[model samples]
Target: MINFYSFRDLTRHTLLLSFIFLLFLGEANAGVVVGSLTENFTCDGQIYQTFPTNGDTKLFEAKLDESGLVFTPRLSPNNESIEVQIKALLPGANSVSLTNSLAFNPIDNFLYTVVRANLNDGKGKRLIIFRIDRNNVVELAGIPENNGTIIDEAGANVSSSGLVAGAFSPINNLYYLTGVRKPVYVVDITDMSFKKFSAHNFNIADIAIDPVSLSLYASNKRNSSNQLVQIEFDDINNPTTIVRKGNAAPISSQVNDAVGASYFTPAGTYIGYQNKPGKIFSINLTTGRTTVLANGPNLVFNDGASCPFDFEVDLDNSTLTIVADDAIADGVDINTIQATLLDVNGNGSERKEVSFSATNGAIIGSCTTNFFGKCLVNVTNVKAGISVIGATVSDGTLTDTVSVTFIPGAGDPLKSLITANPTTLVADGSSTSTITVQVKDSNGNNVNNGGDTVNLTASSGTIAAVTDNNDGTYTAIYTSATTVGTATITGTLNSIVITDDASIILKNGAPDAGQSVISANPTTLVADGTSISTITVQVKDVNGK
Candidate 1:
C-alpha cells in the first residue's frame, strides 16, 4: 500500500509553494522623514503617502506614523516591502522598475494600482495595474497602452519612461494618466490584460479627474505656452475630439514652466496643481479660478507628486464620497485640512474681503473656523474678484502657507506671514534673544493686533516664554541651551507653520581638554605602492559638543 500517486501530489504542492515565494524578499521601512503631504489616501484601511525621496523619485507607500512629526513606511500583514510586492507580481518579466503610482479600486475584492515602470520586456513606459486580493496575493491585472513614443522633447530616443500623473475613475472604470511629450491616456480598468487604453493626444505634465463627472483635465504646454484642457470621457472607448489642440492658453505663456502636477480631492471640491516654483494651485472646477498654496522651495512633493494618496473607494456609494487621507500618531493628528470658503455670505455679492489666520500662527482675525474646515469671514466693504487671501499654519518645527483666492463674491482680505526679526540666534543660556512673528496678508498688509499669542519651541533649547505685544507681532524671549548646533525656532499659528534656525557656537568662555585624530587623505595605496596623508589638530571646550 505504498500510495505512489500521493507522492506526486506532495511534489506538486511543493512546487506551488516555491513558486509563491520565487521573489522572496522584504525590507523594513526604517528611519525616514515624512513631510506635510498635500494629500494622502487609504486603501483597505491602510494609509499611504507619496514623497519624492532619494532625489525626486516619486514613490507611494503604505506608511504609518507613531509620532505626528514623522512617518515610517510600514510593513504589511504579509511582510512585504512595496518594491518587493510590486516586483513579484510584474507580468512575464524577470526584472521590474517602477517610479510613480496611484491606487484604483472599483470592486471590493481588488486593489488596483497603476504603476509607471519598465518590466524589462522593452515595452515603453507601461502603466501596469497590479491587483491585490483579500489574501495579500498580487497579480498583474493589465497594462494600459502608452499613447505616445519613448521620445523626449529634443526629438531623440530617451531611456526614461516619462509617465508623470495618474487618476482612476469609478464612473467609466478607467484611469486618466499622462506622459511627457505624449497624450493623455484613458485606460479601462476592467479591460483584459495587455489591452490598450484609449489615448487623447493631449501632451501634458499632469492629470487629475473630477470625482463626480470622471472628466479629465490637463494643463498642456504647446509652443512654450500652457493651457488647461478638459476631456470628457463618457464613451471610454475612443475620443473624437483632441482635448488640448487649439485651446486658448489659460494664463500667460510665461506660466508654462510653472505647470507641475494635479489631483482632485476625494470630494472633488477642487482640482489642486503645483507650479514650477513649488506652489500648490487649486482651480475650482465650478468657478475655474486658481487658488495658490505656497510652500517651501524644494517642494519636490519636494521633487515628487503632490497628490500622494488615492485611498479606498466605495463602489457601492454613488457619490464616490469615499475615504480621505489623515495622518494620526497617538493623539495628535497632522492632517491637511482643506477648507472651501464657498459663497459664505449666501447673499451672493460679487465682492468680499477675506483674511486668514491660524491659532498656531498666533494671528487672529475677524474670520473664524466652522465645522467643515471653512472660514467664515466678514466680507463687508471688500472689493470683489480674486483678492489674495493668505493662510498659514505651523507645528513647532514645520511651517506651511496656503494661498487662496477670495473671489470678490466670497470673503475678506488675507493676513501676513511672520517675518523673523533676526532670522538667527546664538544659543548661550544667559544671553537672551527676542524673536517676533507677524501676520500679514498676501498684499503685505499687517493684521496683527499685538495681543496674538505666539508659542515658541526649539529642537536644541528651551523657549522660556512668548509675549503678545497687542499689535500684529508676537515676541518670544528665549535663553539658548548649552549646545553648539543650530536651534530651530518654530511659531505655530494654530496650524500655520513658520520656522527659523539659529546656529549655536561655543561662546569663547574658556578652552578645555580635547582630543584629535590624524588620518590619511588617500587611504588606498597608489600604483607606486605609496599614498599621501594629512593630519590636522583641533581643540574643544569642556563640553564635548
Candidate 2:
C-alpha cells in the first residue's frame, strides 16, 4: 500500500494542487475588484482580476482557463509620502497611463512607475500624462500645466485631455481644471498652453462635460464634511453651492475615506459614487433630491486601507465598476465578478395590446408608468405609408427585438366642409336674413372646435351681426337697405370657400292703399280705364241712349 501510487498519477495530482493553490492565493491578494466589466466563461465561473493600489508598481494579471483570454491591469507603485492619487486611467496607442496632479507611466509588464522628466520640470504646477497601448505598454504624452504667462495662480489644478467623462470645448482642445477655488486653469493639450479662466475657491473633486449641452459640472468636496458642492462651468465659472452644507449626509457616513468620489450619470439624471458604502444615489439636478438606488453588501467601504477609489459605468451592459485599494489589512480582494443580469421586461401578458390604423396622424396609444425608467422607443413620428408596426420594450437594461406591423388601407383625406343653410332667399329692405353654416370633414365628422374658423362675408348687403355658436355654425344677419340686387354671401371655413346668392327687389313704397295707383296729379285711377267723373257720365248715358 505504501508504494501503490504511479509516478504519472502523482505528477498529475501535484500539478492540480499547485493550480488550486495559485488560484486561492490570487484571490486572497487581489483587492476590491470593482470595474466596468466582468468576463464570464461558459465552463467555469472564475472571475478575472485587476486592481490598482496606492503605492504599487506591479500591475496585476489574472488569466482564466475557460477562454484563454488574459486579463491584466497596470498599476503604479505606492508613493506613500508622495500620495499619488489615481484620478483617471486612460488607454493610449500602446500603453496605459495614470494621472493625479502628475502623470505616471508604468514600465513594460507593469514593472516600475516612471514620470516624464522632460514633461514635468518639477517647477510650477504641472500635469503628467501617460497612455496605455493595446500591447499594454505605457507611453508618456507630455501635457504641460501652464506654458503661457500665468494670469492667476491661486487654487488651480492642471488637467489633461484624457478626462473623458464631461463636456469639452472644441475652441480649446484641452482639459479644464475647475473648482470653487481661485484661478481655475484650462490647459490645451495641443500646444501645451494654458490660460487662467477664473478663480475657483473649493477643492474640485470631479469634472464632467455634457457634450450635447456643452456644459461642465464640477463636484467639490469641502475640507472635513461629506457635503458635496457642485459648480457650473459657464463662461464666467460661476459657483452655486448645489449640495448645501448640513443638507448632505454626514461626511463620515457618505464618503468614508475617499472624498470627492461623487459624479452624475451620463444623462445627468442621477449622481452616484464609488469606494463608499451605499454611495450610488439618484439626484434630481433641479431640486437636488437624492435617493439611494442599490446599497448593501456589494458596496462596502475600505477605510483608506483598501478604499474604493474610482468607478465607471458601462451603460451598454448596465454594469458598474468600482476601483479600490488592495491593501492587506482590509481583507479587500479584487476579482471581476459576473454582473447580475436583471430581466426588466415586465409581464407582457397583462399589457393592453393595441393596433394602429394606417391613417396619417393617428395616435396608436400612449404609455405611462409610475416608476421613472426609459421606455422602448420605436414608434416614429413620420409616416411610412402602410407598413409593419413594431413595439419597442425596454427595462433600462434590455430592449425587445420583436416588431409589429400595421396593414394599410385606403382612407378618406382630411377635409373641412362648409355648408350654408337657406341656399336661396329673397332679400328686401328692412328684412332680417339669417345664414347658418356648418363645418365638417370629408368623413362626415364634425371638425374639432379649435381646429377651424368660419367667416361670412356679404358683398351686396350689410352684415348687421355675426355670432359663432361654437357648434361649427355661424349666424350672420344681413340688413337690406334700398339696394335692389342679388346679395351674394360667401362663407369661408378652414380655407374652404362657398358662396350663396339671394335676390332682393325694392317694391314701390310697400304696396299702395287698396291696390289703387295714386299719381302725382292727385287723381286716383280705379279698375276701369276712365276716371270717377267719366264713370258717372257713362252710367247716365247708358240709361238715356
Candidate 3:
C-alpha cells in the first residue's frame, strides 16, 4: 500500500536522505574545525605553530569557492580575504542555526554542535546537539535535558535552555556545556545520559580544557579586559563543588570577542577566535597574554573545536643548544650566552620567553627568544669552578643545559716582591739601578693577564714610570740621589694589601769635575819663587768633601 505524506514531512525526509547521502560520501581529513550559526563549518588547515600568520585566509577562500555559498554580512571580510567556507548546506535547507556551540569528541571521532531550530511556531526552541560525521555531514546526537523530552536523574526537566560554550574531555569521555553564570552540564556521549554540574560564579563566554592536566578554563570579560579563569572542581569527573580560581592576568586587546576556545595540546596553547574582528589567536596558559594568530572569515554565534593531534611538537626531534661566544673565565662578563631552540619541523619557532640560570655564576634571569628561536643572556661574576647553564622555556617543558669550566684570570692580590739590581749605589745623580716588582696570585701563579697594577716609589731617588712586563713582573729605573743616604724602593700590586720594599745604599761617588772646586793658599807666593813661601792647597767636591 502506498502512503501519502504532508509537504512538511516530505521535506524533512528529503533532507534526511540527502544528509545520509552526504555522510556516505565522507572523506577523511584532519584539522581544527570551527562552526558558525549558518551550519557551515571548516577545518583549519594552517599549521598550528604558524598561528600568527594570516595565510589561512586563502584556505577559507578556496573552500568558499567550492561550496558556492553566498557571503553574507557576518561572513564578509573587512580588508581581509574570505576566511571560511560553508561545508554543509544544512542551515537553510533544514531550517536550523548552529547558534549554541560546537565541540569535538576524539574518543568517538565525531564533531558535535548545538543548533537552534528556526521554526516560526517557537515550539522547537529546545537546543539540539548534532554530530558532524567524518564527511562533514550533520547528524542528530541528542536533545539536552532542557525542559523537553530529555530528563535528569530525578525524572524532571532541567529548565535551563541556553548553552553558549561547550568542550569535550577525552580523559573523562564527557561533553561539557554551559552559559554565562550557568551550571555546567556534563553528558556521556556513549549513552546520551546527562547531569547538571556544580554551579560557578564565573560569567564564562567560552570554555577550554587542558588535555594533559584535565584542568578546565574559561574566557571571561572582567574589568574591561578579556581574561582567562580556571574553573576548579572538587572532582572533574564527578564534581560536587565548582569554584573560580584565576583572574590574574588579562588576555590582550587582540581578542575582542571570545566566541570560542580550544586547547591545542601539542604547543600547550589555548586557541580562540573572536567574532568582531574575525581574529584567531592563542593564549599562553602560563601568562595571560594573547597573540593574534590570523585574520579569517568572521563568524556569528560561532564555536571552535580541535583534536589533540591537530598539531604536534615533536620534542624528540626538537633540539635546544646553549652556545657561548667565547671561553668562559672567572669574573669575566660573557655577553653572548645564547640558548637556541630549534627542530619544530626542522625550523626555528616564534619568539617565546626563556628563563636562564647558572650554578656558579650570575646570569640575566630571563630573555625572549628572537625570530630565529635564539635568546641571549649575560653571565658575570663566575667563580673558578665548573658551572652549569640552564635554559628553559617559560612552561618548563623544553630545556637545555651546558657546562662550562671557568679559569681563574687574576685572583686576589697575594704577594708582591721588590728587588734592586744594585743594593748599594754611588751618590752620583747619574747612577741608575733597576727596581723589579713581581706579582703573584694566591697559588703563586703569575698574574700574566695584567689584571693587577704595580707602582714604585723611592725614598731618596727619582723613579721612572713603572712598566708592566705582562709576566707578573714590573720594572722601573731608579736614579740615585746626590745626597748620600739610603733609598727605599716600594712596590705594590693592585693596591690591595700586597706591597714589597727594598733598600739601596747610595755611597759617595768619585768627585765629579763639574761639581768640584780646588783652592790654592800659596797662589800669591808662587810668583816669588825665591821668597820660599810655604804653599798649601785645599780640594773639595760640591758637597764639601
Candidate 4:
C-alpha cells in the first residue's frame, strides 16, 4: 500500500496531518491566539532545518545530482560530512599552498586560501592569495612579513616558509594567519598590510576563532598529545593573555592529539575539531559535551591527523551551507530559536524580550537583538506536543507582547522572542517600570501553561514585585535608587533564558514636559453680547521651558 507523491505534495500532507492531530488534543485555556506569523524564511530568505524527523521537511542544503534535487541528512555519519564539499581546491591556480591554509571571513563574506610563492627568498616570499565564491573566483596578491626571522622548517610549500593555520577575528575584523614557527599574522581584509601579533614564541598548530564572543582558540601538540588553549585580546586590538583549557578531548594513557579546528558561527559557542584519525567531532563549550558528527576518510594534517575542513555559517539563517551533503546541523542539542520584532511601520523593532516555555517540556536559551531587530536563541527539552512561547519588547518607554503556541512533532517547537521595554526609566521617587511577558509557539499558535513559572532577575535594579497575568504572561515591577546606572533583567521559561537591559537616569525631577496652559479668569468671556470683559492667562512649566 505505497502511494507515491511529489516532494511538495508530501510536505503539505504532513503538515495537514499534524494540524489535525493538534486540534484533537484541545488548546490550552491560558493561551490566546492573538495573531498569526507568515514569515518563515530568514532575513535573507534562507530556511533552517530544525531537526525535523519526517521526510520532506525543509532542509538547509540540496545536492545537484542526476535526480535533479536531493535533501542532505545531518545526523547520519555514513553520508559525507558538511565541510568536505565547501573547501575550494586551489591546485587549479598557478602557485598556492597545497596545505590546509584556508579561512572564512564573516564580515567580508569571502573564502580565502593562502599560498606562498615558490621562490627561495629568506624573507621576501610573496604571499599568493585567492578569494573564492560560488560564481566568481579571483586571485589576490600579498607580501609576507619577515617577522625578524623566517623559520624555514615551518615551510608549507617548497619555498622557505608556509601558511599552516588561519582564522578570522570578529573583534578587530582582521584575518589571522600563522605558520609552524612564524609569529601570528594579522592582515586587514581591506588593505592586506599585515603585521605579526606581539612577536610570540609559541608555534600554533591550528586556530579556531568564535565570531560572536571574539575568543581565539588554538592548539599545539605536547609530547604527541594536544593541549587546547584560549587567547584573550584583553585590549581586542592587542593580544595580552593565553589561558590553557587542558586537553580538548580525554587525554588517555594512549596518545590522542586534536589537529584541525573550525568555528561554528551560528551556534556562536561551539567548535568543530578533529583529533587523530580525522573524524569530525563537535564540542559544545556551553555544555562541555562532545560528539562525533561525521566520519572521515584518510585525511591528515601535520601529524597525519589534521585535515582541512571549512564551511560557511550564515548566522542569520542558522544554516551551514557550501559544505558537503553530510553536514550535521542536527547534532546540535542547543535550541537555536528565532524571533522578529517590528514596530508600527512594519520595520524591525528594538529592545524587546523574546522568551519561550513548553506546557510539557523544558525551555532553554536567552538573547537580545542588535539594530537588525532580530535574534537567535538556543532552546532545549523539546517535546512532541504543543509548546507556549512568550515575548516583551519596549521602545525605551513602554512594552508590548505576542504569545503563541507550536506543535513540535518530533522536532523543535519553540520560536520567536522579545525583551523588556522602557529599558531606560526615571530614578525612584514613585517611579516604577512594568515588565510584561507574552508566550507563543513555533507555528504562531498561543498556549497556556497554567500560570507557568517564569524566572526573573536583575543585575543592578531591585525587582520589588511580580504579578502573574494567569495567561502565560507576567509583569515584574522594579524601581531603582541609583542615579545613573544600567540594570540587566534576565528571565527563564523552563530553561529558555530571556533578558532585558535597562538604564536608570538620576535627576532632581522630571524636566518640563510641556507648558501648562492657565485658564482665563472669566470662564465664559462674552465679548460680543452685552459687555466686553478682559481675560488673563498665563503659561508655565515645571522647568519653565
User: What TM-score do all the candidates reach, one by one?
Assistant: 0.40, 0.34, 0.49, 0.38
- TM-score of candidate 2 relative to the true fold: 0.34
In angstroms, the error of model 1 at 293 is 1.8
lDDT of each: 0.41, 0.33, 0.55, 0.41
449-519: candidate 2 lDDT, tens digit per residue: 43345666776656655576765556677665444455666666545564333333422233334444323
Which of candidates 2 and 4 is the stronger one according to lDDT? 4
Give lDDT: candidate 4, residue 536: 53
* Candidate number of the best TM-score: 3
Ordering by lDDT? 3, 4, 1, 2
lDDT of 2: 0.33
Model 4 vs. true fold: TM: 0.38
- Candidate 4 per-residue lDDT, tens place, 44-154, comes to 211111112332211123221122323344321323221221122222223323344555555444445554443332333345444433222222322233311233333
| lDDT string, candidate 1, 210-232, tens digits | 55555666666666655677766
Off by over 4 Å in 3: 1-94, 104-112, 117-161, 181-183, 197-203, 210-215, 222-234, 238-302, 305-453, 456-466, 469-490, 493-545
The window of 10 residues in a row where model 3 has the poorest summed lDDT is: 57-66
